[model samples]
Target: MDNAPLVIDVAGINKRFGDKHVVKDLALQVREGEIFGFLGPNGSGKTTSIRMLCGLLTPDSGRGTCLGLDVLTESAAIKRQVGYMTQRFSLWDDLTIAENLDFVARMFGMKDRSTVVDKALDDLGLSGRRKQLAGTLSGGWKQRLSLAACLLHHPKLLLLDEPTAGVDPKARRDFWEEIHHLSAAGITVLVSTHYMDEAERCHRLAYIAYGTLMASGTAVEVVTGQHLHTWEITGTGLQGMGEALRALPGVDLVASFGATLHVSGKDRDALEATLKSRLRDTPLKMTAVPPSLEDAFIYLMQGSQDQFQG
Candidate 1:
């Protein structure tokens, strides 16, 4: 990954909207053909940082290049070679799948419009529904169409903002498969998503909170960096146990996952001792488990001060 050329290299980028500082001295580097996932809580400047990286918004103070084009000076050129898929379905709901692709192709002034449209439809499995109106399509199909439209320009970099927000599980899986396919084709993808499963699928991840970057690295690296210890307990009557566990010494977080609870803390030995003493008389099954990405993220968020909170 280090040997690959950087598709996005920016530093000290900051942005604000009146009194709210949305992004703060952010620095990021994305390699060519990398699937970089961005994770954060709401109003954390994930969207704003994406725009700055792609030249959609100018930074208050920063310097860098995106695809070797000056982000501040050559935004027009950068925009031409980038495909941005917004969070919302921005395609014309009234237009057919094929018509929508054609319209996007026309906007980019692409040549051989028919061939491009046909290939896009086929690539996204929309050919069978070429004549179907986008509004009539399900969330999954609409997502596929949005991706197809973004690719019409043959962009070198793709900036996707919550591309699978409301998509079903099966559709989300299918969409991730397509993203991997694109990365294999040498297209760099920077996507923001709230789903932990989706975040894990990325080659690397960055977690931002309150306009500040808190953690970044491969999924394993991020988890290990936090040095968190966890214990998984599952048994009957575990519903109200989470609140009781949180107040115990050495317990930092208690998160429920279905019928199981993951109790985690930063101090390993202390946490183990505390859990052992507390559950000595109970019949519940307890096992020491590795902290999950979700656990690490929640820990990071809890430690961060929300800059927007009054």
Candidate 2:
């Protein structure tokens, strides 16, 4: 535990409800100042794992520490040192932007709430709309406000669940930019997102499904480590092309990449053989391509929900 290369260190973690096993033998090591993306389908224990890391929820089995504090025994202490921004907007809708920040600062018992609120508003570029009501703000502004409120307490770790669900692309990029800034400032952030572009921006990632840890690494490493091979076939009539590719042996994922269809599978030789064999009758040009992260993700989740074999 002392030598684990992570700010949040846990091993063989397990949890369950009355009937359903929500988490099983979960393990993770998230480094300090790293943006670790927790990728998974809904109800797949992503939120439960984040809770275990920060000590908000107790695991039925296994052990770990967060910020050097005992995850089970020092949960209250860990909670005080973490900032959690849930998927839903938790702030008061009628409060002004400045009021929300001020309230949050006061919640942390800061000596100078006004000063902290002012700094947070200015830092998040919300000073211009500091007086605007939270209910009247756009999704981007609401996202900014949530971030500002979380930062008001100045916690070391930020746990964000689907932080960019509805914001525009520019706003999402801006949010990610701010996350990187926080990482540079030595603040560790664990974010769960559905967007692939956002996943690529993380320092490293862990994919979970059906209460199991599927994969974890940098984007390139995760994709390459899957040993998946892809083929980009360019031609018309792509609507039915996916079916053809899926029917071909060894092909697991057939997704469109703009005007081309990216066909991928775990077995390289078999996949390539299928692509070369199937395209002989069509004008589609077949070329081997590298598997993208999304392709690997699709492959990883193929049979995950089939049944509880473990």
- Best-fitting candidate, scored by lDDT: 1
TM values, all candidates: 0.95, 0.94
lDDT of 2 by residue, 1-310 (tens): 2233577888899999889999999988888889999998888998888878777789999888888888878988888889888788888999998888888887778888888888887787888988888889888888988988887788999999899998999999999999999999989999999999999999899999999998998899889888887888897766788876777788878888789888888788888788888888888888877788898887777758655553
Predicted candidate 1: what Cα RMSD to the true structure? 1.7
lDDT of each: 0.91, 0.86
lDDT of 1 by residue, 182-299 (tens): 9999999999999999999999999998888888999999999999999999898787889888989999888999899999999888888988888888777789899999999988
Q: Give the winner by TM-score.
A: 1
Candidate 2 stretches greater than 4 Å from native: 1-5, 307-310
* lDDT value, residue 59 of candidate 1: 87
> Which residue pairs overlap in candidate 2's backbone?
none
Per-residue lDDT of 303 in model 2: 51
